[model samples]
Target: MKNVSRVFYITLALVIITVIFGAAFPAQFEGITGSIKSYVATTFGWYYLLLMSALVIVAVSISISPWGKIRLGKDGEKPEFSLPTWTAMLFSAGMGIGLVFYGAAEPLFHYLSDSPTAETGSGKAFKEGLVYAYYHWGIHVWAMYGVTALALAFFQFRKGEPGLISTTLKPLFGDKMNGPLGTLIDVLAVFATVFGVATSLGFGAVQINGGLSHLFDVEVGFTSQFFIITVVTLLFLVSAWTGLSKGIKYLSNTNLVLSVVLLVLVLIIGPTILILNMFTETFGMYIQNFIEISFRTAPLESDNRSWLDSWTIFYWAWWVSWAPFVGMFIARVSRGRTIRQFLTGVLTIPTLLVSIWFAVFGTTSGNIQNNGTELTQYATELVLFNMFDQLPLSLILSLLAIVLIGSFFITSADSATFVLGMQSTNGSLLPANRIKIVWGLAQSSVALILLYVGGLQAIQNTIIAAALPFSFVMILMVIALFKALNEEHKKMEAEEEKKQNS
Candidate 1:
């Protein structure tokens, strides 16, 4: 009880201080966050790239190795959730809000801004834009989640360890895991999860506000967005109170249905053929240039390096920040499955859905741009709403989009609260409702404060800064997981030999 209290209050105090400082001195807060983000990106960009690449390789290798057949839990244990429910929850928690927020906007931004490496406003630029968008939302991001979740699941279920990020490193640290080092690791995990989820909540609020303004003429500003965040925070807190199966699972399944309906509507009403063609060509291009793009570091061109830092490096950090929250939630729902099944499902299904999402919304927006819509005229938050305005049944579809975003926001927050509770309560699978409520409120408060002070840029900078230390932790986690798995394999071999001799 004392340990739990210490973790909760210490994390709470740190978050409160940061939020208060940010709210009271907006300019100073922004300057500090911005400077930290810039320093991390400039000095550590190469490391971030290498880390992501290594994670991808590790994820794929683990899925194919003999260890892949090992169940996350005891041998012969079956999966807890059905395939569809599992996929829905993972997708909703992982990147549902981000996809809705950036699907059309990112592609359009790339199209308009043009790449430093690609020609401006030409056929090559179009391909480069889509490829870059795909790259940002591709397997690399899921690979981060995959590796982290795999570590947590293996340690928790197979080894009977607590379901905490620090616990996963027990093989490396042994008894020290019960000391300050372990507590600090868990604290950093909670910090990363809070800010990462808060960043998404901030984005969701901006987009929700933009949708309301487009439909009902409500002004889009800090006040309106703050109200949106408040309302969303309440909704998600209520959902978290209901616990995972009743609140989060149902909402996640609903999110998936609504998302498919929206996708089909856009495809049927928009240029169906063109969207399909673009998807095929862009997918091929993404595959053909996957390695080059993944490892590309613009060492020769300052402009290209800046662009990479802003887009690619920033995205890597964001995904790494999200790994702890998403990974733990995934591990909770992934008991009784083999490492192979978990990795395959986590890596493939979401990536495919994201690609299709980018194809439908991104290509449709680009087509609108080609027809002189000037998508860049609107704010980034308003791009999705504006894109929907051009489709048939604009008002109804826009309302549906808002609902989807709202649901995504709730589901993501609920999952984050659950994960934070587990981390704070020493890896309890079912954390107390009070813990959930506190974390839920803290996440929303951070989002609201950041939105009020520095808007989306502040949120972005915070995520990058918070994720930097956690990225190193994730690398260590991978090493620790490999060591544990090797021991397990050797023990199994020795047991088999003894049985045969007997």
Candidate 2:
């Protein structure tokens, strides 16, 4: 296992280094990796959405099943957190900065552009947009995180296997993956997650830079980007080294508090009537057309193809790239959680919170865009900052917004750092401090390089591309999960029969 991990890392280092130097000269790397991303998206993007949907269905089923009832602890072991606290922590950590990014923008984007339902309509598209955003961002995505996390948590804490995907798959693969195959899964998951998360870091850095630049009227280019990365990295590294109890626990608590406050602030400032109305309409549309939207596969020639690809395909890949890290982190925290508890926490709670946030924030942001707001006149880069700047409480609210974004990014970065350490050190929850520091620094460096290269969009696309292969691995996970469910059921039945006979 060690040899395999070593070889994989060596190869990965070479590839990343090559990409870096290749990207150093702008013209060369763009034509290479950029073309690859476009080609893959053009070809298999629809299939990716289908796979994402399938994974969601599979995860939901597993979450409600009897096998899922099995706790991670040993026979006499007790749970860590009470139900509500555990649920909140799991949802917050699983979600992280994603809420901050998509919360306002995504729904508005969907509302402006057509979704699978109203591809050609421009009327009432804003409500359509919020619903569509909720659709994509809702339970399905987190269900993916929940299932992957459950697999790792159960295998490691319950079955005494290493807390990696390979161990999660051992029930199906048996010992075959215990050698090279298992190592391969871990390596792929690690690589995909690193690049994927680094992309989020890049986005967070850019957004942070934008927020600061808007407040101070400075340029939000390379220097500011690097500055944000350095500051955030130090913060996360400190949190990570402090371990889950002190650093992670405290940060998450802060994150939850600040997020709620931000939401409340938006609700107070925004037009409550418009925001609530849009929320209701969008939600209704989502329910009315839930199946169609979820299963929509308008072909290349179909009118809805472009819209679906932009919204759904992109999100599916984005989530896939993120699954490993989020999954591992969720599993780590869900040590003693029941399957139903895990599912509801991952699916329902975050979705409800995100929906409300979008209703308030996204609606207000979109309202500014719809009206002759000064913010919309600017480029997309400046738009978000300008929108917040124009708010009634611009100065105070903008500062709060900055804090919200920074804290969200910190929560995600710290969690990933912890999980990466665990993955690196053979699935030990309490990995060595040195290992934690190494991963933290590496994550920070990767974020910096990615920011320097093609900015946030390029980083996101590149990371999404890496996840193309692991999408298959996740499919295998879904299958393995069901098989484990069946096996556990059979074991229960046999035990029951033995008891009756005796």
Candidate 3:
């Protein structure tokens, strides 16, 4: 409490007001959010697409440039975690819930419901569906995250700045970043972090509820999701109280194991050849069409534009909104790594791994539908469960999925609590347990409230609305990071020249 700044109180009050509004009048809340979401999507869809695509280019360019030699911390400081542990943590925190939630459903949606460039249910649509799935969750997503995390790590570690979003801009703003404007920036980051994470939590809860309904006939609705959020919130809150190194670290490792087990099982049991083929083919096509897809605004085609707004633009915003939390968390553990190493790992490894995941799940879902399972009849949340129901070891796979989602649910919420605590406090490496508890509950409550209002629709609306401001912040961060990196490189070069002259 003593370390808590006005950011904490301010963000807390804002979240409380949102909760009251959402609770007192759910219909009005959803309606307003929907209107704003629509406006942002229609007006700024091109901006989101361009900004996210450019981030990929910037992140990749920086990693291979001369400045890549610079370490995140003081010279020769060793990394806190090992390679395997680091990758696990990256993949877990970066794409954990999503890999389980949308891995199957996204492809199915694109193929059966609304293909990006092909007629629904056609062969071209099938291939393009998988390709676009790779597009949405591919290197671009990691690029946005990698750029954000790279900046935070560079500033917080090498420059000895606080691990807050606003602090990353001090290179551009100087002392001004410590003013009310800075508080506003941090608040926006915290606000985005809260809502963005809550969206994932909402997905996790719904999928868990869906799995429950499949396995045990548990009712699938708001009540089940509410209960799911409450129980999982308590689990993760306890984990948060245990501290990050032990709780989140170990849980991340556990998530990695479970995720691998589940992925491998799906590969083995559910259309192995199709998954392998799709993984090989789609990844290639994804690369080939990457440029066209990245810049595509669908300006001439209303249907394609509608699909873009619903999927691609939404993903761009969601990733941007989610970046503060994911970026900060990655930055914290990334101390002492070279900029090249951090960016390389963050951009490439997780992207490849998550692509493999999407391939397995997406292709398998497609195969099931092609085999006449009529999977489209299932709700999005239940698609994975029903898809598993038609596979070998159906019960075991379903149960493992439920457990995996639950594990991801806990780890994500736990990590969010830690990040929120640090953001609210003075970017403490180890924030107070009580502060974490407050954030833990607040996140779950927001997720619950949104789910109650309009299910996934409400969550998506809030994400696009919340992400618009932060996208501008991300642009400024990239500029500031480059200026600082260039300045430091020049300083280092001049010092070397002086030493040689002496």
lDDT of each residue in 76-195, candidate 1, tens digit only: 899999999999998899998999999888888787775747776777777678888888988999998999999999999998988889998888899798788998888888999999
Please tell me which model should have the higher lDDT, number 2 or number 3: 3
Model 2 bad stretches (over 4 Å)? 1-8, 11-19, 75-77, 113-121, 300-304, 379-382, 496-502
Q: Evaluate candidate 2 by giving its C-alpha RMSD to the native, one decimal.
A: 2.6
Clash pairs detected, candidate 1: none
Per-residue CA lDDT of model 2 for 137-202, tens digit only, reads 776787777778777777787678877777777777899876888878877887777777777777
Question: Which runs in model 1 stand beyond 4 Å of their true positions?
Answer: 1-5, 498-502
| Model 1 TM | 0.98
lDDT of 3 by residue, 1-502 (tens): 5889999999999999999999999999999999999999999998988898899899989999999999999988999999888888888788789889998999999999998889899988888988888888878999899889988888889999889999999988989989898999999999999999999999999999999999999999999898899899989998999997899999999999998999999999888887888789889998898899899899985557889999998999899988999999999989889999999988889878888988899999999999999999988888998999889899999999999999999999999999999999978888999999999999999999999999999999999999899888999999999999999899888988999999
Please state the error at residue 72 of candidate 2 in Å.
Answer: 3.3
Checking candidate 3 for backbone clashes, the offending pairs are none
Instruction: Return the top candidate by lDDT.
Output: 3
lDDT of 3 at 193: 95
lDDT of 1 at 134: 83
Clashes of each: 0, 2, 0
lDDT, ranked from best to worst: 3, 1, 2
Off by over 4 Å in 3: none
Lowest lDDT 10-residue stretch of candidate 2: 2-11
